[model samples]
Target: MTSGWVFEEAAIVFVSILAGIIFFYISSPSVKHEKKQQLEEGTSLIINFVLFIWAGKIVLNIHIFVTDPLAVLAYPSDAHAFYMAVLLLLVNIVYKATRKQMYVGTVLSALVPIFLGSAFLYEFIEAVWNDNTMSWSHMGLLFILLILFLIRYEQIRPFTMTALIFTIWSLGQTILTFILPYTTLYGYMMSLWFLILVFTISLIALIYNKRKVT
Candidate 1:
């Protein structure tokens, strides 16, 4: 039963990501090819982000990984791994950007939309398939983000809109957690602190980028 549940969850995640990528791919041309490599780079970053989270999960359960790697892989990852993985993902992106002389804002512009789309689909699926009412709050916020993206994709100022949406989503989720403590994000029990941290980080980035020219 547990294995089946895990498989089901994995399937949902895969489908959500694929849908997000398709959306990203389609939307790119609508902008008259303004954003280059957005889809490809976004997909690559998403893969890296997942691998980082998986690595964090394994590190937290090194004994299991050493003994029965298959069992470790089958186990559900802890929610805490997300926090570490997010920081690591940022670091990795910055490191690559500096080394390759790439613009961080471009990466963020691509990454945010794909990530937002996947998140919305993930929450929407959970709400329908798992009967998780707590996902409604997240889905609503994500929907707003999607609509805003549609409106602003053409004139989007790189990190400004992306970080703004992140701030909004995290803030909304943080409030929702108080009203619904059983709230789950990405199939794990929601963490209020995590939401707050994400909010702070995004807000700071938004302010920083808005102030910085180009």
Candidate 2:
């Protein structure tokens, strides 16, 4: 078989695996009451992350089908998909391990920022070192989706912390954009905006949670 056939086969295999994973997770049995709630929330996050990956894949697949098979390789959104998949898997594992812990939310809130911040920083480095361009529209859509998730989850305090950090990062990126005029800087700005948006959503979540508690 030729290289083109090999590439197509690989894509089919990956899509099949992703679909199977989603189906298996969704069909899994519910845990006990409190654990079930955590599972539900984590599942929602996984679903949204998968949806984002699927959307990116759909766009890339369309370009590949119409243009060249190699066109799919031109854009490297696969890294983001892989990253989200790993995160989902980790969340599932952690929730199962720590379900009995009462301060799960507080623990998660503290850890999530560190984990996500690292991912963001890694992506930023990749964008700079690999000479990747910024996808502002995609980032904007992601930001909106994250905000919606925060609203739905009603998690506030952690979200507020995320928002403040993101706002500062975004402002710094905006300033850098004027001074640097580099593609990497532009990408950083896009990422910073998305981060800020995530933070804002977190703030909303914090407010909702506070109201519920009081």
TM-score computed on alpha carbons, candidate 1: 0.90
lDDT of 1 by residue, 1-214 (tens): 7778788988998898888877777665346454656665777788888898889988888888998998878877778777668788889888889798567766777777777788889999988888988788878888998998888877867678878888988888887877776566677775788788889999998888878855
Clash total of candidate 1 = 0
lDDT of 1 at 112: 70
Model 2 global lDDT (CA atoms, 0 to 1): 0.44
| Total backbone clashes of candidate 2, pairs 3 or more residues apart or in separate chains | 8
lDDT of each: 0.79, 0.44
Determine which window of 10 residues in candidate 1 has minimal summed lDDT.
Answer: 28-37
Residue pairs in collision within model 2? 155-205, 156-205, 156-206, 157-206, 159-202, 159-203, 162-199, 163-199
